[model samples]
Target chain A: MAMSRAVLEGRAEDTDGRLLLLDPSDNVLVVRARIPAGETIRVGGGVPVPVPADLPLGHKIARRPIAAGEKIVKYGAPIGTATVAIDLGAHVHVHNVKSDYTPTYHLLGGEAGR
Target chain B: MTMRGWLRSDGRKGIRNTVVVGYLVECAHHVAREIALPFREEGVHVIGFPGCYPNAYAERMMERLCTHPNVGAVLLVSLGCESFDKRALERAVRATGRPVETIVIQGTGGTRKSIAAGRAFVAAQRAALDAAPTVPMDVSELVIGTVCGGSDGTSGISGNPAAGRAFDMLVEAGAACIFEETGELIGCEHIMAARAATPELGRELEASVAKAARYYATLGYGSFAAGNAEGGLSTIEEKSMGAYAKSGASPISGLIKPGDLPPRGGLYLLDVVPDGEVRWGFPNINDNAEIAELIACGSHAVLFVTGRGSVVGSAISPVVKICANPETYRRMEDDMDVDAGRIIEGRATLDEVGAEIRDLVIGLAAGGRTRSEELAHQEFVLTYKSFEPIGPACLPAA
Candidate 1:
C-alpha cells in the first residue's frame, strides 16, 4: 500500500501506509488503521516485514526486531520493556511487554475491564 | 473578548453563579442531596466530604470550594457528630461575603426539618444570586484547566495536542492555564522540567513527578488500567506521553497542588498527587475528583479531552469535552463539545480545532452552554489527601 500525500503532509516522520512513526527515535510504530496478518509494513524504506497477527487501529507494531529486556520506545521515550523477543512487525502489547515503573492491571485472558 | 460575569466580593469573576449545598460528612449527604434536588436545574449543586475523620487537606479543600468564584451562595449540612469542622467551613464561606447557612441534621429536628431549612436557604440564595450585579470579564481573567480521561491511542496525536494548542492560545491571550496528572507524567519529568521558567522551579517540577512515581509504585499500580491496554496503550509512561502533550509548548510558570490557584495568567502544573507518603489510596479515585480539584483551584471552565468518551460535566463549572478518536466521536457526538478527532481523520488541523476550543470557551463565558451543561452533567467528587505548603521555589516570585 502506498502512503498518501495527505496522511504524510503534516507528519514529520514517514509511515509504511499502515504504521505511523511518532518520533524518529521510536522503536515501534502506531497502527494508523487496522491491519490483517500477512500484510507487509516497511520501516525506513527497508524490506517489508509481514505482520504476525491482526493489528488493531491505534495498536503498535515493532519497527525492528526487539530482544527480550530491551526498552520499547514510543514518542521518543521508553514506555516499557519487552518481556520476550519480538520480531519486526509483531504486536507490542501487554502479553509481550510490561511497565518498568509500575504494574499494569488487566483482567484475566487479557480482556478489557475497567 | 469580554463577557458579563458574576463578580464576587473577593474581586474574582465567575462564569457561572452557583449555589452549592455541602454535606460535612457522609451522614449528612442525604439531607444535602435532598436540599439541592429540586433546584438541580437552577444551578444548585451538591458537594461534600464523606469522611468522618478530620483531615486538614479535606478542610482546606472545602474552604477553597465554598469560597470558589463561581459559588454565589453556600448551604452546609452537618450530621452534628462528624469530625469535619463545620464551623470553620461556614466561616470561610461567610468571609467571602456569599450568603452561607448551615443546618445540623441532629439539632434541626432530624432529616425532614434540616432538608426543609436547607431548601429554603438555597431557594432564597438562588433568587438573590439572580439579582447579583454583573461585571465585565476579560479573557485574561479566566482560569482554565485541562485533563484527559478515558484516553486511548488517538488522544495523544489528536485531542490532547489540540487541547494543548488551545492552552497555548489561552496562555498567549493572558489566561491562566493548568495541566496536571503527575502520576501519569512519570517518564516525561525531565522533558517537562526543561520547560520550567526557572532552574529552581524546574527542580521542583521534577521532584513533584518523582513523588507521583514513588506514590503510585508503592500502591503497585501505575494509574494504568485494563481499558488503556484495550485501547492499545501498553504502559503508564505511554499514556503519560499522551497526557503530557496537553500542556502545550509553553514555559512552565509554576507548580501547584490541588487547591492552589494560579497567581496570574500563564501555564501552571497542578500536582494532583499528595505530598509525603502514599496514605489515602489513589490520588484521584476518578475523573470527577480531579475535575472538582480543578474547580477548587478557581478554574472557570475545564477542557476535558477523552478518547474513550466520558460524558461527565462538573459542579460550579462547565466541562468542554474534546473527543479524540474519530469512531468514539461518532459514537458519542452529542456529549462532545469538540471533535478533535478531525485531526486524525485529516479533516481538520490541530490549529483549527484549537481555535474552535478557544472560541467555544469565550462563547461559554458569554452564557453559551456546553454540551455537558446542556445535558445537566453536574458531577462532583472529593477525597482524602495530604499536602505540605509549597516551597519558595514552587512559584518562583510569580
Candidate 2:
C-alpha cells in the first residue's frame, strides 16, 4: 500500500531533534521530545521556528497558523477544531483544540497556558 | 511457516492440545478450579459459564470454547441442578471427537468426591491426547486477532499502526486476521468503511459502530478511561482514531459476532455489541472478554497491544503482549513482547517494528510461548449477554 510520504516517513529520525509532520496536509506537528521556551525547531521542512512556549512530549504544536474554529489536522485527519487562534510553533492540546465528539476534560484547573 | 497441529473432525487445526475442566455454573467453579490446579503443570486449564440461568448466548459461547481448536479434551463440572445444559455441552465436545466427561456434583457425593473424579478424568485425557494423531498446519490455516488495552496517546502513533501493518502482512500471507472493538472505533467508521472489500460490508461496519455508540451513550459512559485522559487523550473520538489503527490496510472481508468463525482466510471485524435491546450491561466488560471472544472464534493466539502496560493472557489461547509506550516498557519490560514505542523515539521505524511483530506472531504460532504464558497469566472471564443470530450478509462467503 503506497501511503503519503508523510505517513511513510513520519517517524524519520530528525537530526535537529524536533517535531513530526505525520502528513503533508497536517496542520499540527507532534513534539518529538520536550522543548523549553525560545528553542528553535524545524516545522514542516521550513526554516527553524522559535518555540513560543514549553511543550511536553507527545503534545501537538501548530506547524502553521490556525484560526479559531478551523480544524486541527493531525495524522492527515481532523482531530478537533482550534478554540482560539494558534500561531506557528504554539502548543496544541485540550486547552486550545476541542474534540468534535465530546467535551474535552482537563485534569488540572485551567492555569497553565499551552 | 508449517507447524504440527491436531487435526479435528470439523476440518480445523489446533496449535495446542489443551484439556479443559469447565464448570457448568458458579456452584461448581471451586471443584473445577481445584481439579485444574494440580494439572496446571500439564495443558489443563479451568473455564466455565458462571451464570446459573439458561442463556442461549452463554451456552453457545461455552460450546464454541469446548470445541475450540486448542482444546483436546474436556471435563465438565455440573452442580446437578443448574439450568445450564451439560448434555448439550458434552455433545458439542463429543461431536468434535474430543474426549468429554461430566461429573454431577450432587450425584458424586459433593465437592470432595467430584474433585477427585474430575482430576482422574483429566489425567486420562492427557494421556489420550498424547497419543492423538497430528497433522501439518499452514499459515493460511491460522486465525489471528488483536486488541488494545491501557491505550495512551502514543498508541495511535506507534503501537496500533504497527499492529495494523502486521495485520496487513498476515492478511497478505493468506492468514485470517481479525481486529475488533467497534466501541473504540466509533469515530473512524468513515475511513474504515472506505477500506471495505464490498460496499455492503462497509455499510455493515458503519452500522456496527453506530450500534456501539448508541449502546455506550445509553450506558451514560464512553469507553474512555481516566488513564486515557492522563495520557493526553481528551475525548472518545481522539482515542478511537488511535484505536482504529490496528486494522491495517487490508480490505475487510466480513463482520462476525462472538463464536461466529470467519468463513475464509482474510481480514474480518468482530462486532462485539449485543444485538436488539441493550440487555447485557456492557458489550465487553474488559479486555479479557474480548480476548475470550477472539479465542472462541478459533484464534490460535492473540496479539494484545497496551500502552499503560497490562500483564494478562487468556485461559486457552496464548497472548503476545506488545507494549506501545516507551516509558511503560521501561517500567514493565518483563511483561511485553514487542517494544513498539521505539517508533516514537526514532529507535525504529513502524515498518521495522511491524515486521518484528509479524515474525514474533509466526514464531508464537509455531509453538513458542509468549511472556504472558510463561508467567501463568491465564485470566478468564465470562458474563451474561444476548445476541441475535447473524444474517447471511454477515459472512457472505461462509
lDDT, candidates in the order shown = 0.86, 0.82
Angstrom error of the Cα, residue A11, model 1: value is 6.0
In order, what are the TM-scores of chain A for the candidates? Answer: 0.76, 0.76
lDDT minimum window of 10 residues, candidate 1 chain B:
B222-231
Leading candidate by DockQ? 1
What is candidate 1's CA lDDT for residue B358?
Answer: 93
Chain A TM value for model 2? 0.76
- Each prediction's TM-score against the native? 0.94, 0.91
On TM-score, the candidate that comes out on top is: 1
Candidate 1 CAPRI-style tier? acceptable
Give the alpha carbon lDDT tens digit for every residue of B3-93 in model 1.
8798888888988899999998999998899999999899998889999999998998889888888888999999999999889888888
Q: Which ten residues in a row have the lowest lDDT in candidate 1 chain A?
A: A1-10
**In candidate 2, which residue pairs clash?**
none
